[model samples]
Each structure stands twice: as structure tokens, then as C-alpha cells.
Target: MRLAYVHILPLEYYPPATNAIRIFASMDDVDAAVWTSANRKSLPEFNCDGVRIHRLPFVNPGTSAFLRFYQCLKWHWDCAIALRKFKPDAILYIEPHSAIAAWIYYRLLGGKARLFIHHHEYYAPHDYDRPGMKLVKLGQKAEQSELFPRAEWISQTNESRSGFLAKDNPEIAAEKFQIWPNYPPLSWNRKSTQPAINGPVRLLYLGSASFHDTYIRELVEWVARFPDKATLTISGFNVDPAVWEWLEKENFPNVQTFPQGWQYDELPERLHNYDVGLILYRGNTLNFVYNAPNKLFEYWAAGLEVWYPQEMKQITHLQEATTQAPLRRLDFNELPTEGPFPRPAALREFRSDYSCENAIAPLLRAFDL
Candidate 1:
């Protein structure tokens, strides 16, 4: 069966698009291709893990909603043209904007391919109050504008997201939304030997540096307070200027900085060098409260125990699901002064249960290929 995977973001920049391509490539009975936009300034064609990726022109999001909606319409036209040529049996649309574009292609333009949508986030109606959220809500509204009852839905978390959609739109059946958690491929197993826990435990904080409630600087300050207990390494794209300035001015003895972010494929091998992974989101919104972030699984795949906020519902749920025990829960206001810190012991079982292959099994089953 031929499957067309569609997403609005640049394929190289979006982890979810790459993850979907990798998952689809692993299937023996399916032939998968990706359709996405290249960077606005550049349109370069490259093969990713044996899948042929087609790139179209995309306008970057602007401050004005009119411009953003116009861009979305242009993207819909591009996707419709691509659909006519590729002629896949089914289309898997990633994120709300891409799914909305696919909906337009099928419903308005009389396309024949069955539509499926993957919801990577759950945004409440009131989530538009924050920065960058207004545009996100606009895209989400596009999906909700029509029920699309026949369209299959997938979520990156279990009940947190699926439950919200079902509650919001009672017309949609519960079975329409499948719980496909954000899991990495099975090959990212930990090494036989890890960084020793005898000395100061090596820790990492990776991903986006900009968030309203990130405690990165606070973590650095705490590490400085007890330099002999733990050390931290920080890196990610678009590291907030404030974070960089603070890191430079403070120059904590136990904190190391990497200005450049690591590529997605480079994380598995690189993560084993650290003893712990830190997730310091302050749980500012319901979306954050329900997040099943990629970093959580990436850290586990690399054999690093998590140092997460106990307040996060996603973390709490994952703790119960994976090991039935709490990880090193942080209070945010305080740091431990002890010698040895906690690490996870159940990665093998976690890997077996939530590998990307296993996570996407329900998606494949839905297609009946």
C-alpha cells in the first residue's frame, strides 16, 4: 500500500515528521513517502531513511492572522496538487494545519484518499492568551470547524489528549482517537556501561530554551550552590538570549554550555554520557500539564534517569505506567544536597512496551495493511 505523509513544517526541522517517516519506513507491507514544505528560503531535496520526501513552497508565519490564513490556503493548494500526482491509498497528516489542509483537499477539492490526523498537542479554547498560541489556536480551529467524522485521529498521549477531544466533541467516537504515545525507535538502547554515579552525577537539559516557566537558570544556580554534588550540560536550538547572557555572567563552576544544538539522530549515542535528564517545565498551561515530551523517551532510550517535576500530570502518569514508581521528582524551589542521586532501573521494560514500532502498531492496524 502507498501512503502519503503530510506535514506543514519543514521536514528537516520537525522531529514529529522525521519520527513518522522512520516509523512508516519500518513497515514491511507498506510503501511510504513524505510531502512537506522546505525552508522558505531554500528548497533542497534529500532522502531520509530511504523515504522519498517532496518539498513545496511555504510562507513562514507572520504577525498578522490574515497572512497566516492565506499561507495555509496556499499550502492546501500545494498539497492538493501533490495528492493528484502521488495518488496514495491513504494520507497521514501531522499537526492541525496540515490536517486542515488535507481536509480541504479531500472535502472541497474532491480528493479520494482517506484522511488521518495526528494530534501532537491538546489546546483548550482559552489557550490563545499566550504568545505564539494565538496562531496555534487558529490552526486548531481549522480542524474543529468541521467534525470530519470519518477521519481517524491519533494522539501522542493516552487519555489526557484523547479524553479532552472526546469531551469537547461528543459527536466523535472514543475509538476514533488512538493513543499513540511519543516513543522513539527500538534501536536506541542504552550501553552496557554508563557514566559512574559515584562522583557528581552528570546531567543534561536539552531542547528549546525559551519557555515562560523553564527553570534552567534556577537549575544552574542550584548546581552552583552544590558544585560537588552534580554537574549540568545545556544545549538546544534558539537558546534564549537571556539564558546565554546569564550563563556567561554567572559562569557556574558545575555548568557547561553548548551553544549549538545536537541533531535528532545524534541524541541516542550522546545521551548515554549523562547520568540524568532534567525536565523543568513549570506546568503553566493545561497543554503543558498533559505533555508527553520527546525528551522523556529520548532520555530513557539513552539510559538516563529522569529528574522531572512531580506536578506534571504527564510525568506522573508515565511514572505509574513505566515503573510504577516515582523518578527523582523535583520541587523546583529546592535542590538535593545528598551525595548519590536516583536513577531509573526499568528502561529495558519501558523500551519493550513503548518502542516506536509498538507505538505505531495501532496506526497500522487502522489502515488494515
Candidate 2:
């Protein structure tokens, strides 16, 4: 079966979870391709284990989405062009704008192929959708203005987002919207060798260090409380010099800074040695509240505890890993200071289910290829 997929954040196969459904959906005997805007080495085209990926590439260089609205519009246009060229048997539209691209493909193909939308982040019931329902409705019109109906099947990652999509559009078929859990990768069996508990335990914060989510000062202040007792390691993106200066001023004496990246596969392997991981997002907006950050799963992959706020669902979902330890106010007791219940079986289950096999089963069934 010839299948095409599209997403907003480009192709990221290395971090495992970034390409979870991609790996599962295109697993065995399914000839598939991908189309995305985020440019990462010929991804959507990588040959891994036994999968063949072909990404329809479109680059928007020197372009800035000074505004969020225009950014989505530019993304939809690029995806539409990419779909028109690849013409696969079906399209799994993973992002809002990409769904519009797939819809245009269906219209041009005379509905010969199907279109499916994957929803990883959706607005909860009590709250307005991400950016609010007002913005969601606004986005709907913007995409419909380009493609006729936009999406055929909306596969929600969880129930919260699904309800919002079907709440007003009950006329939409029920089968088109199904539940697909976001199970992290199956590397859980490989637990990090526990570091010396008696010595200072190593705690880490990985991924983007931008000021948007975590202000450097807040983390420094939190670490200030643990100068001699705990050590915090920093990685992801080059550490800004200003952040380094601030770290010195905060007097986090034991703090260590390392190059902020690893060969995508190297992280889980490296994580095995750390005691616990830290997630410090300041906002409680839809971006933070509805997020199932891949890092949480990666933390699980390493069998390390995660220090996070109560607002984080993934932290709450995984009983073994996530801790309610507040970073700024801080409490080390909330962290998993001891023990390793190696969960390889959990990872095997997660890999099998989240492996492109289980994740994309619905899309494959929908197309009947």
C-alpha cells in the first residue's frame, strides 16, 4: 500500500518517540512516505531496522512566522504542494495544518485515497482548546478556505481532545475518531545502572533550554538550595554564555554543564546513569497542560525518576517515574531517591503497542490496504 504522512515539526526519527507512529505505521509490507516542514537530514526517508521512508520535502528558508497565525498558513501551503506531488494511496495528517494539505490531495484525487488526522495534543473539555476554541475555530476556517473539508478521520491521542472535535460535529462518524494512547518507546527494559547513592546524585534537564519554557534563573535558584548535596547537569542546544554567567552568580557550586546534545540514540543509553530527570515548564497553557512531552517517555526509557509539577499528565500517568517535586519551591523527597524496578517488559509492551505497528493500525484498517 502506498501511504503518505505529514506533520508540522518536520521529521525526527532518532529520538524514538518523535517517529513512533511513523515507525509503527510503516512497519511490514506497507510502502509508505512522509512529508513535513521541519528539516532534519532526509527523514521521513530514513532506513531503519526494516522500514523505508520517503519524505516529500519543501523548505521555507529565511521565513519567519513573527505571528503564529501566518506560521500555520505557511505550513498548510507547503504541505498541500508536497501532497499534490506524492499522491499516495492514503495520507495520515498528523498536524492541524497538514490535515488541510491532505484534504486538498483528496479533493484533487477525487476521493480515491483517504485522509486521517493524528491528534497528539487536543484541548480538554473544561478548558478552551489549545490557543482556545476561539482560535481553533479561527484555524478551521483558515484551513477550510484552502482545502474543502480538511480531514476525513480524526484519531485523537487521548479522550480530552477527541471530545472537543466531536462535541460540535456529532454528524461526523464515530469510527473516524478513535482513541490511540501515546505509549513511550519500549526501551524500558534497559535501566540505567544506578549511580552511587551515597555520593551526590546526578539530576538532569534535557531538551530545549530556551527561556520560553524554563527561565535559567529559576532552575539556578532551585539548585541554589542544594549547592553541596545535589548536582544538576544541563544539556540540549549550546548553553548560552549569559546562562553560564547566571549559573556562577547563583552559586550553584556543584553544578556541571555539558554539551547539550547526544546522538539521538545516545540519550536513553546515557540516561541510565542519572538519578532523576527534571521537567520545568512554567506555563499551564494548553501547550504545557495538554503536552505528553517525549522527554517523559525518554526518562521512562532510562528508568530514571522525573521531577515535575502536578499539572503534567504524563508525569501523573506514569506512576513509577514522575515525582511531584516542585523545582522552585523544591523537595527532594518527592523524587525517587532510591531503587530500580527494571521494566523491560513494560518497554516491550510499549514498543509493541507504540511501535508503528499498534499506533498506525487504525489508519491502515481505515484504508483497508
Candidate 3:
């Protein structure tokens, strides 16, 4: 089976899209290709373990609804032409924009490829009520009303979000939807041995750090208060300018920031040194409240214990289900003052359980491959 993966974002920058394509390509019966865009930061061509990647030209539709609408139409046209040429048996479309493009190809362009939609982040109707989102809102509405019913399979990050999606689109059958939690590949597991805690616990908050609706300030301040007990490292892309400015001026002795964050492929090697991986989402939106981010599994794969907000009920449910790794819930109101937050000792035995290889089983079963 030839499968084409469609995503508007640069494939190399999005771990989930890359992971999914890799998984599909690794299958004996499937030949996978990625149709994506080249952002300013991304190379026109990328190596996804030898899978074919075709990138459309990038257009910076900066904050203009007209420009964004034009770009979207152009992308749709380009994607449809590519799909027609590729003649894929099936297509996996990530995010609403990609799904809308796939819908256009399948419906209007006489493309016969089976459609699958993956929602990396849940978005409500009102979520797209901003200035440059009129086109996006229309596309999302079309996806809910038309695409959902036609899709052979649809996936969300977790069961909670899947339930919410089903509720929103009652016309689509429940069985059509599946949960594909953001999990790292089993190959990425590099479980480090737990050493005896001698000094301060190494706490790392890796990934997108934002000033709004996150615990960045609180975490930094708390770590600053007790430099002897803990050290904080903030690293990742899309870090808010406010965060950078504050960190630059404050210059907390125990806190470090790596503005040039490590790439997704380097995570297994890069993350093992930390004792704890902090998830700092403050649950300001419904999407955030039930987020099953890839970083959680990435941290576990690297043998680090995870600390997350109590407000993320989906993560809390995952924590309850697993004894493979330790997942601690943080109470922002009362920060813990303690020493020796150690890495899990059972990582050697249980780290394999938190892999994309295992997570994608249900997806494979659904495909009946």
C-alpha cells in the first residue's frame, strides 16, 4: 500500500508527523511519502529515514487574513496536484488545514485515496475567532460537517479529546475515531541508569516555553529560591520574548536557558541527564486541559520522571494507568521544597512500554494490516 502523509507544517519540526510517517514507512506492505511545506527554518528537502518528502514553497502570510487565505488555496492546489501524481492508496492528513486539503482532493479532484485525519491539538469552534482565522474557521466547520463523516479513521491525542471530538461531531460514528497518544518510538528509548542522588536534582523543562498559560515564571522563581536543592534548565523553541528578557535580567544562579533547543532526533541522548522533565501547561484552554504531549513519553523513554500540572486530566489518567514510569502532579499553589528527585530505577525494565511502536498497534489493527 502506498500512503501519502499531508501536513502544512515542516515535517522535520513536527515530531508527531515525522513519527507517524516513519512508522508507516517501516511497515512491510506500505510505501510512505510526505507532502509538506518548507518553512524559513526548515530545509526544502529532509531525510525521513529515506521516505520521499515533497515540500511546497513557503509563504509568510504574516497576520493577514487575505494573504493566509491565498496561501491556503495555493497549498490546497499544490497538494492536490501532488496527490494526483503520487496516486497514494491512503492519505494521513495532520491538522484541520491538511484535512481540508485532502477533502478537496478526494471529493472535488476525483482522488480515490482513503482519508485519515489526525488532530495534534484539539480546537473548538470559538478557538478560531481571531482576526486571521476566518478561512481556518470555515475549513474547520467543513471538516466537522463533511470530512469527519467520510474519513476512514480519525485520531486525537487522547480518549478525553476523542470523546470531545465525537460529541462535537455527532454525525460521525464513534468507532471511526481512535486515540493515538504522542509517544516516542521504541528505538528512541535510551533509559539511563539511576545514579545515587548526591546534590541538587536536575530538573529540565524542555519544549515550547511561553509566558502565557504556563508555569515558566513560577518554576524559575521557585528554583531560584532554593538553588541548593534543585537546578532548573529551560530549553526549546517558540520561547516567549518575555521569558527570555526576564531570564536575561534576573540571571538566576541555579536557572539556565538554552535558547537554541535540541532537535527532536537528539532528545533521547539530550534528555537522559535530567532527573525530572517538567510539563508546565497551566490548562488555560480545553485543548491544554486534556493535552497528551509527546514530551511526556519522550522524557519517560529517556528514563526521567515527569512533573505535570494537576489540571491535565488526560495525563493524570495516564499516570494512573502506568507503573512503568513515575508521573507526579504539581500543585502550583504549594510548590514542593525538597531534595533528591531521583530518576526511575525501573526504567531498564519498563521503558519499552512507552514507545510509539506499542502506541501504534491499535492504528495498525484498525488498518487490518
Candidate 4:
């Protein structure tokens, strides 16, 4: 049996478990080829476990949102052509973008392969529960209607998505929507818990593109007051030079900014050393809400307690101890001052389910491998 995997989302080798379903599937003898988009800036290919990969061409010259969308569309076409050349018996697609496009292409082209999709995000609007967020939800639901039923079957990471669709759209079989959470690569390992930084905690701001620069500004405001006690680190690729220079120029006593420019497979090692893993995302867009962030598990794999407002869907496995919301304005005025942050015991155990043992089963069963 041969499978053709296609996606344009980011890819990396370390954390071993990052995008692990694709990595592990590629490792199996039945695994055929993986066709995915390469970095927008450079194309470097390493043997990702055992899968043969084809990187889509780098086509972005501007950072406009429309241009980025065009690049993703262009890369999918590139990936589709690549898949046709490989001629696998089946196609396994990743969520958000993969399912809808593949369905349109497969129907139009009439390929011999069957198609399947897996979704890890439980996408909701940033203001989902508010009256103002109505139009936002409408847009998302419309997008879902266009895409969700197109799949022969789908695997959702959280219960809400699977359950909502089964009720809202009965045309799709209930069984087609199963709970499919991310599995860390079987190679992922637990790291020693990183003790919080002394004096003040070191906050890590992780992002993929320039979209998250706003969060860094908020961090600057918070850190400006506690420069003696706190420090912030921003790591990601494709950031503007002006943003970098602005942060440096401030020369705050407690802030240092570094561009963690695209290091795959090396993430686990790099993350293990950080004091706290920061997951600061602000968006009402489809990509942000439906996200069962890979880094959530990656941070756990490295055993760092995360600092976010609340847990995300599909990955609230803060089985051990977790901090409370609003680190920006921590209001512990009435509480006792002398206790530990009150997290659960060891994080190593909570991370186990995210490892391949739990994550890979659904993928295997999906293909009957």
C-alpha cells in the first residue's frame, strides 16, 4: 500500500514528535512520499525520519496577507502536481487547508487514489461567545461547510469539533469524525523540568511569522515595569528588521529579543533550556482557534510549564501543576505570598499520551496499516 501525504504547514525534524503523524507514516514501509511546502525563504531537505519529501517552490516576495494566501494556494498546486507524479494509491491530508483543496483536485482530475483528512484544531472565533463575534463565526462556519463534507472521512483532535459537526451536518457520517489528537513522534522523550528562572521568570514568545509582533509589544509594556525581575525572548523566523531594532533600542533591563529563525528537529533541545513556554496568540481567524498547537506538546516534551491565559482545546493536558491565567497582571493580593506556583507533580507523565503510543493509533487505523 502507498500513501501520498500533502500539506503546506511548517515541518521540522526535532522534537521528533512535531508533525509526527506525517513523520511516522513516512517511516512505515507502506508510507510512500510526502509532498509539502518548503520554507518561504530557503529550501533545505533532510531525511525526515524515512519519508521522501518534495518541497514546494519558494514564491513569496512580499509579506502581504493576500500574497501569503496565494503562496499557499500556489504551493498546494505544486504539491498536487508532485503527488500526481508519485502516483500513490491513497492520499492522507492535514487539516484546515488540505481536505478541501484535495477534494476539488481529486474530483476534477479523477485519480485512482482515495482521500482522507485529519484535523487537530478546534477552531473558534476569538469572540465566539460574544455578540460581536457573530459575523466571525458565520465566516468560519461557511468555510467549514465548504470544506468539511468534502472529505471521505475526517479525524478531529477535540470532541467539540467532532460532536458539533455530527449534529450540525448530518450528511457526513458520525463515524467519519473521530477524535484524533496529535501524537508526538515515537522518538520524543521527556526532559528534566526546567526550574523557573531565578529572580524573575524568563518568558518565551514563540511564533512562525510577523503576525505575532503585537504580542511582543504587550510583553514590552509588562516587562518595562519589572525590568529588574523579568525578561522576554521572542523566537521565530521572517520577522521585520525594524521590529528587532525597536526591541533592542529600548534596552530594557529585563528584555532581550532573539529571532529563533527556523530550526527544525533542534526545537526540543532549544526549548528544554527555556524557563517558561509562552503561547501568546491573538486572532479570530480560522487558523488560531482550531489550533491544537504542536508546541503545547513540544513544551511538555521538554517539560516546561506553560504560561497562557487558559488551556487550548485538544491539548489541556496540564496533568501536573499549571499556572493561573493573566500573568500580565497577576492579582494575588489577598492570597498567601510564600507558596510554590502550585503546579501538579511531574510533567513527564502528562506528556506520555502526546507521544506516539496514543497519537499514532488513529493514523494506523485510518489506513488499516
User: RMSD of each candidate?
Assistant: 3.2, 6.4, 2.3, 6.2
Instruction: Name the runs in model 2 displaced over 4 angstroms.
Output: 13-18, 21-26, 38-85, 108-111, 123-139, 142-152, 168-171, 210-212, 238-245, 248-251, 258-260, 317-369
lDDT of 4 at 138: 41
Writing each residue's lDDT as its tens digit, candidate 3 over 1-77 gives 88888888777667777777777877888888888887565333456665888888655756466676777778877
Query: lDDT per residue, candidate 2, 252-369, as tens digits?
Result: 6767766545555567577766766777665456556545566765665565655665555544544334232212222322433332222222222122112334555565566675
Which residues of candidate 3, in runs, are more than 4 Å off?
42-45, 62-64, 337-352
Candidate 1 lowest-lDDT run of ten? 344-353
lDDT of 4 by residue, 1-369 (tens): 687776545454222224554545555468667665555445344445567777666446567666765665667666666667677777877655454346445644556576676655554434346653343354345335644555556766656566754665677767778776654554556655555345665566665434342345654556567655556677766566766777778777666666646465666777766555666554344345344556666666666666543323323333223443122212222222332243333443344336656666676677776
Looking at model 4, residue 281 earns an lDDT score of 52
Task: For residue 126, give model 1's deviation from the true position in Å.
Answer: 1.7
Task: Judging by lDDT against the true structure, name the best candidate.
Answer: 3
Name the regions of candidate 4 deviating beyond 4 angstroms.
9-18, 25-28, 43-46, 56-85, 99-101, 120-152, 163-168, 193-199, 208-214, 238-245, 283-292, 310-352
Give per-model TM-scores: 0.88, 0.70, 0.92, 0.71
lDDT of 1 at 10: 78
Better by TM-score, candidate 2 or 1? 1
Please report how far candidate 4 places residue 351 from its true position, in Å.
5.6
Instruction: Give Cα-based local distance difference scores for all models.
Output: 0.71, 0.54, 0.79, 0.56
Q: How far in Å is the alpha carbon of 239 misplaced in model 3?
A: 0.9
